[model samples]
Structures are given as structure tokens and as C-alpha cells.
Target: DLTPRQVTLRDRTTIATIVPFSSRYGVPPTLLQYLSDTMNKEIEGGDTYPMMDTMTTDAFATYWFQNFGAIMLLGTYASASAVTEGNDWATQCLGSFYIKPNYTGRSSHISNAGFLVTDSARNRGVGRLMGEAYLAWAPLLGYTYSVFNLVYETNVASCRIWDALGFKKIGRVPGCGNLKSYPDRLVDAIIYGRELGGPLDEQAGEERFDKIRFYLKYGTYPHGADRAEKSRLRSAATHYRLREDDVLMLKGREVVAEVERQWGIAREVHERGHGGINRTTTTIAEKFHWVRIKETVSDVIRNCKECKDKEAAKTAVVVPAKRKLDGAAEEYLAGSEAAPSPALRGEQEQMVGAEQNDEQFHVPASPPQADKTLTPHQMDGEPYYTSLEYSGQTPNAFQTEPHGDLAPVHLHADAALSLDPQIMGPMRDDFTLGYPQLHDSTGQPQFAEEAFHIGGHEVGRGRKWEG
Candidate 1:
């Protein structure tokens, strides 16, 4: 009757017997400590700031165990040992589990988590093994998919493992995490996810698993370095494969040489012909014709005016000598070296002295009467005194030389030629005046005009003249 008399509501719920806590109810303190320690270590080691600590671990464990029943407890138990192996392993194992449900309401597929491990425990298949285990377990925990919401882009090892696990990248946050070894260089945070219950063939799953294992062992994907190296090698090989002949052709070497040779031959042919070369008429094929060169040169030699004139003079008919006009005239005429009479020397002595006086002092005479009877050629050729008209208007007096055949005279028109007293007078009087003088072989003035004329018209004092 001691307890049966009035059993209180609180007493009723409490049993008198010693009831032990279920083995499932209480986790091993060592395992809990390990999980907490591993998670804390991984979060600290990660690139992101404001990481989880002991308090976070306790909160996560309380929420997970409270809501999800025995499943969460079992997962916690399994993940504890995995985390002790390495940071990567702990991240992969615990990264998929959701401690708080409905994180994004309707879009709760977006999940974020991390892992922890000592440095010495890496590269031993621990990270990959845990990743595979998580993929296998995620669907049973009512998760449609698992996501690595933030992963540093420069974390090559972590990226390789996740990619090999068939986790497709969905998004990226630029410059969200620190690049390892380069604290100042921020890296992109990569978002990755994989469907929990999506279509997955056995072969594809096996292939993916195999790839993860390969990455763990070799630390690279298929065709990574080889692909890049092969492309570089191909480019180099293409560059070296070009032919020397093709290169010469592209530079037009043969074409340029052919053009130069043609030009040389054309110049030679034109010279041999003695015909003024017509550059426009010259052709490549014509330049190489030896027969044409000979023909043209022969024609030029046959028509030479200087040779014809010399031959005509040499073959002229002879004329007999006439009787002497008087003894004085005879002596003067005979005084020549070829004289046939003795009387020529006495008369020639008187004439020679008079000619010497004429050379010493002379004056220009008045214009002569027009010789209307003479031809234009004869009128032009005759001396000025003999050709000038008394009326100051000789017939065709202003006419140019016949047939425009005036010889090309070398005229000294340089500024130094102005030193002549006669030239300096006109040049100083009219500052724009130019004095041009015909030069003899010895560079002395042969002929000069006080006021110049060309083409029968007087040139104005200041006008430019083209000789």
C-alpha cells in the first residue's frame, strides 16, 4: 500500500527498476569526441571563414538526433570513424547529411557541409572511399540530392575527386575562398550536386567509381596532360613541315629573277640597235632574239649621216685650175702651202698683216640688204653681216632652224656663270634675270646673247628658259 495508495503522474512514468539507456540512445563518448574534433579540424583547415567549432558540432548532433530518429544516430556512428582518417574523408561523408531539415524549403536540394582530418592521413583512398559511401547513403536519408555548396576552385585535388564521383557542377561564386599557399589570391567557390534517385546504369556507376579510384591513385583525369602536350606537338610539327621550295615560291623569288633578266636583255638589245630604246615596246621574248639585234644594228649603221657625208666628199669630181687674175693676186694665192705659182707669197704677206690688224680691233657693221634670191637654208647658214637686211626686216628673219635640227648645245646656266661682267649687268638690273652661255670644250663662253631669244621670239628678262 506504500506506492499503490496514491501513484502521482510523474511517479507513474518513472520505474522503480533500474532501466539502462538503450545502446542506440547513447553514442560512445570517444566516437562523439572524434566526430566533433574531426569536423572542427576540417572547418578550420578549409578556405572559407566562420567555420564550425565544438558548439556547432553539439548543436548539429542534437538537431539531427532529435528529428530523424535512429537513422541519423546510425549515420553519425558510421561517419565518426571515417572523419578520423582525413579532412577530405570527413567532408565527403558528412557533407551529404542534413542536420536541419527544410534548409531551403521546396529547394532543399541545395546542401552545404565540410570535413576534417590530420595531414598525415591523406592520399590513402580514405577521401574517395567516404565519397562513394555518402553517394550510396544519401537517398535513404530522404535527400533528393547532395551539394557541395562551396568549394574553392583552386583546390585541384578536391575538385578532381568530386568530378570523378559524377557530381555535376551547377554554379559558382567568384572569389569566395582563399587559394592555398597564396592567401591574397581569392578563388571561385564551385557548387556541385548529383541526383539521389536519378537514372544510373550499372556500367555508368561502375565507370564513375573506377574514375574516382583512378584519380585517387594517379591524381589526374584521363587525357589531362597528354591532351595538352599532344596539341602543342601537333602545332610544332605543322610549322616544321613547310617545304623550302614552297617558301621560295611564296616569296616570288623566281618571278623577280626572271623579270630582272628580261630587263637586262632588253637594255642590251636596245643599245646594239642604236635606236633610242622604247621601254614600253620592249618584251621578254624580243630581248633574247640575237637575229633582231643584228638586223637593227645593221640598219642604224647603214643610215649614218656622218659616214655618208664623208664618203660623198671623198668621191667628189676634180676641177682644173684657172689662169691667175694678176701678179699681186697670183702671189697672194700662191702663198698658200699648196700654191702652184711663185707670185702668191708677196701678195699674201700684205693680206696677212691687214688680217692681223682686223683681228686686233673690230666693229660690227650695219645690217646688210636682204638676199631674196637665196634659199632659207643658205640664208640661215650665212654670216650675220651677209644675211642682215637694210630695211631691218629680213625675210623669215625670226624663223627657227630648218627641220628643228639645231644641235643640243651644252649651256652653263649655274649661279657661278653669273660672274661674267656682261652677264652680271643684266642679272643685277633685274633680280629675276638668268644668264645662260654656250660653253666650248675648254669651258669658255663660245656664244652669249645680251637679250636672249628662243624659237624666234625674244625671252623676257625674268622668265625661266628651258634649253
Candidate 2:
């Protein structure tokens, strides 16, 4: 049996008194020969440990002890009689493996390792002991996570050990394993993984923002003595030096986007109104700092269906355009046809009532006409237009036969027909009069002799206008 009578590190310091168990050099030659021979015998026909199919014992030992970043094992005490017979062995060996993250640049992580147990150590908890040790040491060795790539489906013992130790079965590969007992038959390979420190929360375990945070706190670069990186870090630190939480702040792209998406949704739905991009951006900036927050908010609002629907409803409310006349009768008649009809008065009333104020008009008794000139009178403290006196019969003197395509008759200013003051009541007082130089289908100045009120009142008709 093999036992540690004295333990010493490379420095010759006696660690046996401090360490609970004995530590030794890497897998010895005899142990490697034993493990290699056993793997070849037990795993050659089966699909387990396929990498060892042609590897020599020396090559196997070199690979594990030299190539691997770290090595661990399960040591069992043997009787003195067994050592005297020149026969002692390590129950199992577990080695740590690492690969470049994404097969690219450097990373502070590694993968779960595999182990080999001697036939005599089967069901003796030797595999479990090595696995537990691996879990404990992986984090200390700077591996935050570990993934078991191939656990044969038939290897129920190893699977159970992993599961009981908080490892989760994440996925499986079908027809990838060959059972030792059924070497001709293929089986599925299961993948298992677990975070040594438990699953990370949102933005947890992400170091993308760490550099910025460090610069914010120290007002200097964290690492990378390179001139370019140092310059960049210095620039970034200056930009954020005035910030209150610059040192502890997180400014990653995905991180900010996630926050904006959440807060934007809440503001849009919970706030007093449909607070759009402007409001959302402002609200988020008050709590968190990020550049281009407006752009992020705009993107969120663009995809929001409810806001789009509300905007569409607002755009659908339409007002009819005022009609204009021409010197030619046919052209004037055509335009008049497009004007809102008296037949639709009921529908117009219903719509106008819903949209306009109840105090729109305050029409009093109509006054008798006394003269041709217009006089303004105040109603509801606003000026209004009243009727003009007419002593003669309604004259048709201004009416002329339709002259085909005659040049538009531009009336002189003296012939201006004053519009009813009531027509201006609903509109703002500052509104510009659009009557001058009114064009017809011929695109020439138009002349008219009639005046109508918006309330269907014909205030002046058959009056001559020169302008």
C-alpha cells in the first residue's frame, strides 16, 4: 500500500503538518502505465475515452502531467503487504483542461475535466471524490464555469454523482457513445454543466463595463501598459470623471438597451399619458447615464403598436377645404359641386358638435338693411356683420352669359365684396383673407358678386365687385 510518511513542496517546506492529506508529484510512471493499460483494455472497444485508443503510456502521462494546466487525484491507502509485493495504485485521476475562449483571444475560464478510475476502484466512490475535488478547485484556479462535454448515457453512476453535486444536465448528443458491455451498439452522450457560484443574474459576470468602472473610480487606466490602450482609457476616464457613479457605473450597449426597453415600457403604459421617446429618454437619463438614449427610446417607440394606432386615429380627422369661384361658369360650377352639400348638414352637425365648442355662434334677430356699406356690431364682445338694405328687386344685371374660356376678369379694389363678419367668428381674428387674387381653372384672377355666411345666410347677393 502506498502512504505519505512525509510531505514536502518543491521549496522543501514541510506541508504535511498543515495539509489535511498528503500531496505528491504528478502521476508517477507506474500509475500512468497502469491507467493507460486499463483505459486501452476497458475503453478501446467501448466509445469512452476515445483519445486514449492509440496513446502510449508515456505519452499519456506527459499529456496529463505536462500539457494539462492542473492535475488532481483520489489516493487510497494500501496495506504494507501490498507495497511489499510491489503493487500499489492511485484509484483515479482528474485533470483540468482549458481552451481559448471562442477559440480566439485569451480568457479566464476553462472546461470541466474527465477522469479515469481503475477497475478495482469501481463503485468505491473514487470517481465521486475526484469530481468533488475538481469542483472545489476549479473556481480557485480562475474557472468561473465548467461544462462536461460527454457523459455516456449508460454511465448512470457518473451522471448521478454530477447531478447530486448540483450539476445540471444541459443537453445531449445522440448516438455518440458506445457502451462497454454493448460495444457494437451506440448510445447518446449527455452534456452537464454548472456554475460554481450559481447562475449569474442580468449583467452579472459581465466584465465589459469593468474597464470603464475602474477608470471612473481611479481616474486612470486599469491595465494594458500599451500606449494606445492607455490613451483610450485616459480619455474615457476624463469624460466620466465628473459623473457621480462613474466608478461603479455600467455602460455596455446590451446592458443599457435592456434597461431602456424595460423603463420605456413602464413609462409608456403606467405614466399619466403616452410618454413617448422624449419623456422616456428624459426619465431614464435622470437615473442612469448613457449616450444615444434618445435613439434607443425612439427605436422602442417605433416598434410599439399601441402608440402607432393612437397616432393614426389623430391623423384621420379631416376638415373640408373652402371652395373658390372662377370667371367661367362651368369652372365655378365644377368647384361648387365638390363643396359640402346642404344634404349632408345633419352629418356635418353631428361631427361639428362633437368637435367644436357649444358657444360657437350667438345669432340674434336679423337687422333690416339701411345702406350698401357694411357696419360692424359687437356680439359676445366680438365684432359681427349685419345685413345691408336693399330697395330694388334682386338684380341679375351682374350675370353674364357663359363666354367660353374668357380671360379671368380681375375686379378693381372698389368692387371688393365684404365677407360676413360671422364667417370670421369661428376662425382666429388674425387669419389672413385669402380672397385677393383668387385663381380659377385657367389660373387667372377670379371675380365674384355674391357673399355667403358660414351659417347658410346669404348676407349680400347681386352686389358688384371691381377687384
Give me the candidate number with maximum lDDT.
2
Estimated TM-score for each candidate: 0.32, 0.32
Q: Which digits, one per residue and each the tens of the lDDT, describe model 1 over residues 48-162?
A: 4335343455664564344322111112222222223232332222222222233677876534434333343354333443455455544555677677877775454465457
Candidate 2: 10-residue stretch with minimal lDDT? 14-23
Give the runs in model 1 whose Cα sits over 4 Å from its true position: 1-26, 46-60, 63-102, 109-113, 117-121, 199-467
- Over the stretch 1-467, how does candidate 2's per-residue lDDT look in tens digits? 12322212111221211011112134345655765676566566564654535678776555544423323233332321222223354433322222222112354475557566566545334444455555655565566777888887555456545754667779988777656665555677778988865533212211224445555555565443357656666665544433464333434222332332444544454344658767777766665654345644564565445686788999775434443334312211233425556565445544343223313221122333344532223456554433344433122211222332111222324334555454556533422213232233443333344554456665454332223
RMSD of each: 36.7, 20.8
The whole-model C-alpha lDDT of candidate 1 against the native structure comes to 0.37
TM-score of 2: 0.32
Angstrom error at residue 157, model 1: 2.8
Identify the runs in model 2 with alpha carbons over 4 angstroms from their true place: 1-26, 45-47, 67-87, 90-104, 178-180, 183-185, 197-467
Candidate models: Cα lDDT each: 0.37, 0.45
Q: How much lDDT does candidate 2 score?
A: 0.45
Pairs with steric clashes in candidate 2: 1-78, 1-83, 369-389, 411-466, 411-467, 412-466, 412-467, 415-465, 415-466
